[model samples]
Target: MAAVETMVRVGKAAHGRGVFAKRAIRKGTLVGLVQGKVIDDAEYYSDYCIDLGGTLSLEPKTPFCYLNHCCEPNCQLLLTEKRNKDGSLAPSTVHVKTLRGIKLGEELTIDYAWDSVKPLRCLCGAASCRGWIVAVNHVFDKSTAY
Candidate 1:
């Protein structure tokens, strides 16, 4: 929700809806901040929740919640934390950044690399698609070997 209004738009994607670049974006550009509320329990975790470190999670608002995954992704999630005056961690913020130069109209994507209990089949269509929405190390596990 913190993305510049003119910089991105939502459109049709292979998995339903996806975020798309509204203009050419250079590598390392700060695409947008993912604004959301902290999810305090695992039972509330949804597919849209972003893992904050390993213990915390965030459920981001629109635009960010619509980002889809691709094996050969052009973007990545960046987590930033500010320290509180007492030396404790403040709530972290997630930023989306371009991993490579992205052309205008290209769907913005990140590798989900989910370590799910029940992985879903991927339809990203990337040449190097891992086929399942799981972490790279788990992609070849005998139970779900690709």
Candidate 2:
């Protein structure tokens, strides 16, 4: 398949830098791969790192690293398994795909599914805003926005 154009750009966001769609993107389209070096879980914190299941993380090297978290995200991360040169099966690829049709200039976001290690105060402003972003299973009092 021909590469999809670089359909996103970096821009200001409520919290800080964020990724924005440069043009309308259809639902279920593959946004792109998360390019980066894999690191052990003990590295310094960076907003660009993604948890690659226990004890491992991906430090993104591309603009896609700027994607922010949203309670109601328009994109989702999917993992694909591949055979390494050594002939071992491993989950070696992560892809970002659109969850719904997005308008030009709209922010591209993903549900971080963040765990409680370092919860963040969410300001996504979505109607279903979870108040605080924590681990997927961690429950918090939602009476007040965190």
Candidate 3:
């Protein structure tokens, strides 16, 4: 069997560690898979937890965890569910896909849209920067956009 080529690499970013494109990637490409330990506690919290539907969350590993946020992002996360023959639930998965073409060496980013307890200041530097790492729905005022 032929080996699959890697599409991303980890490197330093303005926001600390970040994922970068190893090659020029086209729009809608599957860039990476978010694999992690599944935490069943709905009340569990972490800086790295990713919602996996229902009462589950993912503590993503390595490359996936290093992906940072951008107000105007070039990537997006997609969650998919699986089921058994009996129609019961199975393990879910999250995929990182490109929303637009990504150039080699360009840092891959997603809209975190976090509704964090203590809202984090954003340094994504996108022209349309929301100024905070928060969900748009949580932004109530122009002055305090979180």
Candidate 4:
């Protein structure tokens, strides 16, 4: 809540649509909320969806849905709890935050670790690019080769 607004814009990425910073963003600043409808984990693979926790998922409703995966990402997803109108604690929701200072026009990304059900070819172009976007455990294990 560092007086920051939706400092992001959706644009073409190397793979597909991606979120880009509209202005410089300081590290640890809240970019925006990930609005979505709560759904069961069975529907997790649907478009714009993220796992909330065990057996639950969120189908993103905002432009954050355009966010793509990167091995070296500039942003991260965090869960936060807020009070409801009745002063009861609501279910935790995911928020996007900067991991470090991001320059204007830089694409916003997150390490989609351990969440992907199947291995995917990575086009993130990071120096440490793992070639494929898969769970960390599968990265170095030859048995689970990407």
For residues 71-121, what per-residue lDDT tens digits would candidate 4 score against the true structure? 899999998765679996555789999999999999999987754545667
Which candidate comes out best when scored by lDDT?
3
State each model's CA lDDT, in order: 0.83, 0.78, 0.84, 0.79
Question: How would you encode candidate 3's per-residue C-alpha lDDT over 1-146 as one tens digit per residue?
Answer: 11113788889998689999888898998887788899988799898788887788899988889989999999999889977799977668898989999999999999988876577779999899978888977844445444
> How much RMSD separates candidate 4 from the native structure?
3.5
Candidate 2: residue 14 Cα off by (Å): 1.7
Worst 10 residues of 2 by lDDT: 137-146
**Number of clashing pairs, model 1?**
0
lDDT of 1 at 138: 70
Which is the leading candidate under TM-score? Answer: 3
Candidate no. 1 TM-score:
0.88
1-146 per-residue lDDT for model 1 (tens digits)? 33556788988887689999899888889888889888766566688788875457899888889999889999999989867799976668899989999999999999888887677778899898987888888744546534
Candidate number that wins on lDDT, 1 or 3: 3
Order of models, best TM-score first? 3, 1, 2, 4
Q: How well is each residue in 32-80 modelled by candidate 2, as lDDT tens digits? A: 8888887765654666677765456778865777889999999998877
- Please list the residue runs of candidate 4 whose C-alpha ends up more than 4 Å from where it truly belongs after superposition: 2-6, 41-44, 81-90, 115-117, 139-146
| Cα lDDT for residue 15, candidate 4 | 75
What lDDT score goes with residue 95 in model 1? 93
